[model samples]
Target: MMATADEGVILVVEDDGAVRNLVATALDVHGYRHREAASATAALLDLTSSTDINLVILDLGLPDRDGVEVIEALRGWSRMPVIVLSARQEDADKVAALDAGADDYLTKPFSVEELLARVRVALRRLAYDSPATPTEAAIYRNGELLIDFGAGVATRGGEELHLTPIEYKLLALLARNTGKVLTHNYILKEVWGEAVASDLPSLRVFMATLRKKIEPDPANPRYLQTHVGIGYRMLRVEEAARL
Candidate 1:
């Protein structure tokens, strides 16, 4: 949110050889060059000392410290995006990872296709951070939904809508890029971290809840609009904003 992609590096720190190779290979296939670390300490050292780590793919089950600990430490000095890669099978772990500072997560035994897609989303979240404000990541608005990129906050008709952590994130990802069609996998990877991808029905339930909070007409949502087979889009706030 603070800086764009051209501003630095994309760091990947994982301990599992299979996962490391798979992830690293996936990134390579996608033509993404990155830095990798086998432990949290090395990652922290790299993160602090280097000025180029634009994003991070971290593992919670580290040899030295908790994977979440690295994220907390890095967050102390920077807001670089952190995506967790772990085999931890608990919803609490996913929540803690996200609460700790991770922007996304992926469980073990994930497909290269899914991994690649997540990489795209995490990197896309940094779209505003590019060298230029490319049109794809251009400032978006609809009705009363006000997105102040500089503030990382949203408002409706001069009134702020208090959002839970997940709701706020869902809005930012969907609303900030209005017309774009994001998929469930994309949203799940971004918001729930990678461990919960199989929970699509749960994703739907959250979407419904999220819509009720932000939509003026939850039954006929005007802003948090669904795209049927696709994900969702925030109908231009101007369409519903009380000008």
Candidate 2:
């Protein structure tokens, strides 16, 4: 049975008519309501006209204007999730889109399963971040670092640690998903967005900065362990404290 779901409305912004149709058809079959726009201008107009849009699947190669600008403009007023669907596979391009505020990025020739998985992850995050979602952890302890998600504070050895917004988000995401290996793409989507998922250098740079603050020795991270070509892992209590 095709399970009926009120997953929420989505806006598809793509210049390719066939691609747009494909995406719309998939969303429809999955029981999601969607609208389509052929250009950045149309996308902006649709966003302004409609207030119920829960997510946006945007293509970076639009005819009217750069999709990065659209992402920035939308970030100025909205927290709606954006998944960038573009053919540009270059790392720089991906970084630009992600840094612009895209929640997820998908290269062209992507599989339907991958696209749908990204959509589900993006929407799941949207719900978790929503105020309607109740949360319980006031303090998260991973070795010496203490993250107070409720109070928006993090401390090390009893002193509050100053962390950038991105740094904090990274830490919180890892802490919540403790003992799990988060792929680079997953981290980017959850932390920065999909557009920046392919920007491994940027992720490494931020991770380095974050380690300096929390790790007793950034050279030898006790809490944040790199998974070599795969991603990163936050070890469980017993595994992480082996300093």
Candidate 3:
């Protein structure tokens, strides 16, 4: 079945009434069903009590608790997509939210169009990861890049791109979660296990090398996008084409 904006229920968690209303209005205009929560407690209650909430648009500052805390709490069980919408512009804040398990981050005074675009991406990823869909494929293709997971090889434009073992692991991890942000800590834990979970420097070095192998112009990358202090995301082929 084709996915539509009306297919899932979105939870909008913002303490600021004006901002919350604005976000809710945009979702309503876009034909999306949504629920609103003015505080972290309310948000968490709603999330835990309801199984139909498909995604979340959360603000960092809440009346009762910090948004990152809510994200961490939510991550304790749910893999539901959370997009942090905050006034906190610092890379540190963004990294914190992502590390706490947010799927995406958008700073306050954001463009509605961009927010909706991100919502679409998140929801699409949710659908893609749903059990109804096959979790893994023998091969994954994005434009000229093709990763044959079964064969354990990646190629670009019909040519095999030699990648280090670490690079290959990183590529496969990102590819599997395309369109979702992967924090340094999360990537490290997943790819290298807990022993080197704090090794951000090594992850950066490996990611740099991986980009060079797959990207036609590493200077202007079309596939992998760096989120500065946050982490990295593997853009879907259609999304990368726009970049």
Which model scores highest in lDDT?
A: 3
Colliding residue pairs in candidate 2:
98-195, 98-196, 103-193, 103-194, 104-194, 105-194
- Between candidates 1 and 2, the lDDT winner: 2
Which segments of model 1 are wrong by more than 4 Å?
1-8, 130-150, 154-169, 172-243
Root mean square deviation (Cα) for candidate 3: 12.8
Q: Write the per-residue lDDT of candidate 1 for residues 1-243, one digit (tens) a residue.
A: 132336356688988877787777777666676888999889888888887667788889999999999978877877667777788857678767766666666677666676665666566656544454433334446666676655556677778765434556788888756767788888877765575566575466557656766777787667776778777766665553432
The TM-scores of all predictions, comma-separated, are 0.62, 0.68, 0.59
Cα error, residue 122 of model 1, in Å, equals: 1.3
Which tens-of-lDDT digit does each residue in 1-243 have in candidate 2? 132355667899999999999999998887778899999999999998887788899999999999999999998888788888999987778767766666666788877766776677667666565443246546788767788776667998899976545566788888888889999889987765554466576577667667778887778778898999988887765686664
Off by over 4 Å in 2: 1-5, 132-137, 140-148, 151-170, 176-227, 230-243
Per model, state how many residue pairs clash.
15, 6, 0
Which candidate, 1 or 3, has the higher TM-score? 1
> Model 3: per-residue lDDT, tens digit, 55-122?
99999999899999999898888878888899997766765666676766677787887688667766
Candidate 3 positional error at 72, Å? 0.5
Root-mean-square deviation (CA) per prediction: 7.2, 6.2, 12.8
Ranking by lDDT: 3, 2, 1
Error of model 2, residue 78, in angstroms: 1.0
How far in Å is the alpha carbon of 49 misplaced in model 2?
A: 2.3
